[model samples]
Target: MDILDKLKNREEIYYPIERNRNTDLRFTLYDAFLAKKRFERFAPLFMEAFEEINGPCYYKSDLYKSKLGADVYLKLDSELKVAHSVKARGGFNEVMVKVEDVLKENGMLDKFDELSLNDIRKIMAAYTIEVSSTGNLGLSIGLCAKAFGFKAKVHMSRDAKDWKKKLLREVGAEVIEYDSDYTYAVKMGRLSAEQNHMSYFVDDEMSEKLFLGYAASIFEVAEQVASSGLIPSDDEPLHVFLPCGVGGAPGGIAFALRSFFKDSVRIYFVEPTEYPCMLYSFVHGEAASVNDIGLGGKTIADGLACSAPSKLVFPIVDSLIDGFFSFNDESILRAKKDIEEIDEKVVEASSAAALLAYEKINRPKNSILWITGSNVDK
Candidate 1:
C-alpha cells in the first residue's frame, strides 16, 4: 500500500525520504546556546513568580530495563514542577522572556531584584498574555501569567478538557472556548492579540522563544544521560521517542539534540493516527491540514490533536527527525494501562504515545522514552 493508504489504515511507521542530518538550518547552534542562557537567566523570576517552581527545570530518569524488557530509560518530564507537563518548560519561559523584554524596554531591568511582588504586579497588570491550546499549553501559560500578575487569555479548542478550562479560570485566566478545532482557535487567538497592543500572543506554531524554551531542556537531559554512563556515539547511538503536537516542543528538542549529538542520536515523533500533522508536513514539504487527507483529526490524545504542523518548526522537524509513528485511541489507552501496570504510574494518553512508539521501533541500546506530561485524573 501507498503512504496515504497506510495512513488511512493507521499503520505504525513512516520514514521521510528527505531526512538529512547535515542539512543547512537557518537556526544555528549559537542561537540555541543563546536560548539556553536566556532560560537560565530567568530562573530566579520563574521561582519568584510561581511558588510551586522551587528551582531549575530538570527531569528525572528511571531505568526501566527489566519491566519493559529493553534498555530504555523513562525521561519523566511529567514530574516537572509547576504545570506537571513538558509544556511548563516552553509555556512558562515564553511568558518570562516577554516579561523581561517589557522590563528592559521600560528601563526596569536593573531594578527587578529590588521590586516587590506588588510592584511587579502593578507593572504586569498593564499587559496580557494570550495563547491557544488543546489543554496543557493553555494551562501552563494561564498558570504562569496569573502567577506573575499578568492577565491571561487562553483560546481553547473543542477538544480541550473541561477540567483544564476550569483550572485556568480558577487561576484568573480568561478562557475563550471555541467549538472549532485547534487551527481555528490559533487563528482567532492570534487575531485577538493583534488588535490589542498590550496583549502578547504566545504562538505555538511560530514562536521561536517557545521553541527555544523547549530546546534548552535538552541540556539537562544530556547531563543526566552522561551521569547514567550512557553516551551517544556512532556505535551506540541514542534513540529518543517524543509525543508531537503542533511540533514546537518535540521539534525544538530534536533540533538541539541533532546539534549536540551530530548524527549520534535518532529522534522520532509520535502523534495520534488521524492527527499526524508533523508527519504530513514532512512528507508534503509544506504545512497543510490533516483534513486534506480526509481525516477529521479526532483522538483520545487531545494534546496531540492539532490539524496542521507548525510552519516555524516544520523545517527543523523535517531536517532532524528520523522517523514518525501514528497510534490510534485504543493503542494509546492500552499503552497507558500497560505503563501503569509496569511502573505503577498512570500517564495521560498524550504522554503514553512515546511508550507505544518505543515499542514499535527498532530501538538501540540507549533508548529514551520522553514522557511529555501527566494530567490524567486517575
Candidate 2:
C-alpha cells in the first residue's frame, strides 16, 4: 500500500516500572516470567535470520551535520538483512512468533534446543501469511514467510515500487496489487484473513508482535553505541531521529530506547509534510488521514506516504517521542540528492528523512539519525 497506517492492548504495558517487568515490550509471546526466555529464543535468531553480525551505527561528519548543527551519527539499518531495510527486524519477528504459535498449538515444540528443523518445516508449510504494505515491509515479510515455509501474500498499493513486488513474486510470494492507497490495501488484507482459515495478517499498523520485534533492536543499538563510545547522559544526551511511516518501527524503537536510556534520551519522528499522518494524529487527538487533512499526491518518499498514524503505535509515540516533525518532498529529495552528490551514496528519500529531522527542530548535541531503508530506484 502507498500511504497508510501499537499494542495498546493491555493496561500495564504502558505503566510505571515498579514491577521489575519489561513495560517496554508486551506481546502475545512475552510476559514478566517469559521475557528473558522470549529474548533468548528470539534475539539470537533476530541477528542470525537478518544477517545482523555487522549491525552498524556510525558517526559521520558531513554537510548534513553542519546543516543540523549537531554531532550526528547514522544507524545504518538501510543495509540490514536480505531485505536491506529496517522492516527486517519487525517482519522477521512477526513470522517467528507465528512459528512459536504453530509449534505450541500442535503440542510440538518444547525448547529451541529440542526442536527439529525438518519437523518445524513440515508444520510451517500448512500455514499461510498475508500483509499489506507500501514496499519495504513486504520485502521483509515475504522473505521471512518464504524462509519459514509459509505460503505468503503481500497486498500492496500503487505507491509501492514495482521492483519490490517483482522481488516478492520471485521469492514465491503472491503479490496482490491495488490501484488504491495503503489503507485500502490493508482493509482488503484484513477482509481476506477474516474469510480464510489458517491465514494470518501481519498488520503493520497494529501488531504487538511486530512492535516488540522492532523494539528488540534496542539491544543491538545499545551494543553498537557502546562500541562507538557514544554515551547517553544529561551532559551528552542521545538524540534519536527515526523516519515515521505507519509508526510501528519508529514508535517501537523510541519507546524501547526510552526504557533503556530514560531521561538521558530524546526521540524524534520525521514524516513527509504531504502525509504527516503521525503529526496530525498526535495533535488532533484521533485517527486523522491525509485526506482528512486535505493532502494529496503520490510521493518520491513512498514509504512515508502513509495516510494515518497507526492506532497500535500511536500511544507509544505520543508518550515516548520528544517531538514530531514534518518536511516537504522537496526537502527530502534535496537531502537524498545532496547526500548522493557529496558522499557518492544512493539512499532512499525515507533514509534522508531522519537527517531532515534536524532541520525542523532545535536538536541536541549527540544525535543518532536512523537510515531506515536503502531500496531506492535509480
lDDT of the candidates, in the order given: 0.81, 0.71
Pick out the ten consecutive residues of candidate 2 with the lowest summed lDDT: 6-15
Q: Give all TM-scores, in the order shown.
A: 0.93, 0.83
lDDT per residue, candidate 1, 237-340, as tens digits?
Answer: 89888899899899888888888887788888999987988887766668888888876457899889999988888866767878888888999999888877
CA shift at 83, candidate 1, in angstroms?
1.0
After superposition, candidate 2 runs with Cα above 4 Å error: 1-70, 111-116, 375-378
Model 1 error, position 35 (Å): 3.7
- lDDT by residue for model 2 over 1-378, one digit each (tens)? 112221111010111112112244443322211422454565544444445343322111122232334476777677564777778777877887889899889886676556555556678999899999989988888988887789998999878989899888988999999998898999999998778898999999888777776777776677777777677896677988888888998877776787788778878888777677776676566777866646645777888878887888775565577676676777789888765676555678987877677655555577888878764453
Pairing residues by index, what is the TM-score of model 1? Answer: 0.93
RMSD of 2: 7.6
lDDT of residue 341 for candidate 2 = 75
